[model samples]
Each structure stands twice: as structure tokens, then as C-alpha cells.
Target: MTASRPHELVEDPEYFRDVLNSMRMIADKNLRRVRFGLTGDGIAPHYEITVPDGDYMEHSVRFPINGLTHHTHHQSPEPFEVTNLTEKFSWDDVIGMLERALSRKRERK
Candidate 1:
């Protein structure tokens, strides 16, 4: 490759190693595996990724610890409601989730 690009564009192998180390630390602190993946539809434009629709825990977290409060006891936030994939379909709720997350109004129930 030519050197015309910025130095940051030339990522070193150490970048991945460092990212792995950071992820290890995060997993250790949170006690959970950090998962990341594509919603699929975004890549296919209008198309949706289908999976079984069922009830899922759809876990989330909240931070109660504060630096100023330091040693104070931490409290967990209220659990929010969500549904899981139970039956497979050609559609995905990712777009819907993205919409809701972005504060866009839902089209229908």
C-alpha cells in the first residue's frame, strides 16, 4: 500500500492485541462477555434478519457507583421490559430497536 494515507490508517497488529487486553479488563470488571455483531439488515438495506421470536431476558445494566461516593453501596437500576425471538421469520426487530433507540416514532404496534 502507498504511504499517502494517514499513519492511523496503518493499524499495527498490536492494535488488536491491545484491544484484546482492554476487552479482558472490561469482561473482568463487568463479569460478562462483551458481545458485538451486526444486526444484518443494515447491511442488506431494508431487508431484515429473522430468528425465532420468544421471550428473552434482553439484559441491560446501570451504573450506581460514583467516584465521590466511593465506598458507598451500589444499587441496581430497575429492569426494563423486552421480548425475545420465539419463532423465526424473514424480519428482524433490529430496525425497530434502532428506531426506538434513536428516538424515532414507531410506525405501528
Candidate 2:
């Protein structure tokens, strides 16, 4: 089963649409789906947000998703492991990355 978030982010009982609106906006801007961050607790995942491990690690990868798959990806210091990047653009994966990035950005702020 997928992990559950801590507190409810949208306190309003009817803010579900609003949340989706925010997510859609982020997706349009990022060229990928972006969702809210869930910081790590004893239960939350992504304790190693910067490092790739298990099903989350990938360096240079060819995405199977058409339209975006043809684009070339830039290299990074992310351990340079070869793996399929289709996960990066997946709805769930994009949201996970977005969540982790959001938490990290808040730490800097």
C-alpha cells in the first residue's frame, strides 16, 4: 500500500478542486506533474531524497513515454546509473519528485 500523509493539507472540506488546480498549474509550469511535499517522519519515505536507490535511482535514461521520450536528458551527479526514466514523467513519480523538492526548498527557506 502507498504511504499516507500526515496532517490534512487542505483544511477546507471542499478544497479538493483547489488542490488539483494548484497541482495542474505546477504541472503546466514544470512540464511535469507536481504535487505537494510530504516531509519524512518515521513513516514517510524519501529519507534519501538526493540519492537514487531501489526503484528510484536513474541517471541517463530513455523515457518510454512518447512525446517527451525523444528529448535528451542532461547528466547530473546523481551517481550516474543507467535506468529507464519513464518513471520520472509518470504521474506518480513526478508527484513524488515534486513532493520531495518542495520539502527540500522549504528547508532552504
Candidate 3:
């Protein structure tokens, strides 16, 4: 089963719409369906991005959300393996990661 989020976030219609729209905007054809949630600790925002690794193989990566809405970028890092997900961007880095995923998607197709 998928993990649940805080009640406040789940109950807010406007926030829900915004998050849905953002996820739709970032969806890539090459990757599996994108899933998002807070980290297991339930403090940091996390995204489960299933990206293609190679021929007939794919991997799900947990990427930390960093932005004005999520200010955990400068905080102490999580103890997980996120070496590939850590990159600097003027805004949220997820957009760039998704863009890369899209590019790969296009190239593969």
C-alpha cells in the first residue's frame, strides 16, 4: 500500500489541486508513474521517481524536494543514498530531473 500524508495536506482541496497539477506537468512518458510523499520520518518531502536504467530495466529513486515550499535543502542530509539526486538548481531541482527524464524518454522512443 502507498503511504499516507498528513491530514491537513490531504484535506485541502486547493493544495491537492496544485499538487496534482504540478505532478501532471512533470510527468514523463519514459518513466513509470511518479509517486510522491513525505520521507519515512514524515518531515521531508520525497518523490519516488521510476527512471529507466537500461534496456528493459528501470529503477525507482527517492529524491528530496527542495524549493520555496520545501526548505529542507540546506538542512542536514538524510542517511539514505541520494548521491545522484543531489544537484543545485535556482529553483526546485526536481524540474530539471524530470526534464532529464523527459529527454531520455524522447530519446528512447
Could you say which candidate leads in TM-score? 3
**TM-scores for candidates 1 onward, in order:** 0.20, 0.23, 0.32
State the weakest 10-residue window (summed lDDT) of model 2.
Answer: 63-72
Residues 1-109 of candidate 2 have per-residue lDDT tens digits of 2224421232222233222333343223334332222332312221111222334445422221111111112333232232211122334554444466566557767
lDDT of 1: 0.24
Q: What is the lDDT of residue 33 in candidate 3?
A: 35
Which has the higher TM-score value, candidate number 2 or candidate number 3? 3
Winner on lDDT between 1 and 3 is 3
Q: lDDT per model, in order? A: 0.24, 0.29, 0.37
Q: In model 1, state the lDDT of residue 58.
A: 44
Candidate 2 deviant stretches above 4 angstroms = 1-89
Which portions of model 3 miss their true places by more than 4 Å?
1-9, 29-57, 66-109
What does candidate 1's lDDT look like per residue over 33-74, in tens digits? 222112222221111111222332244332221112221124
Clashes of each: 9, 0, 0
Candidate 1 residues lying further than 4 Å off, grouped into runs, are 1-10, 26-109
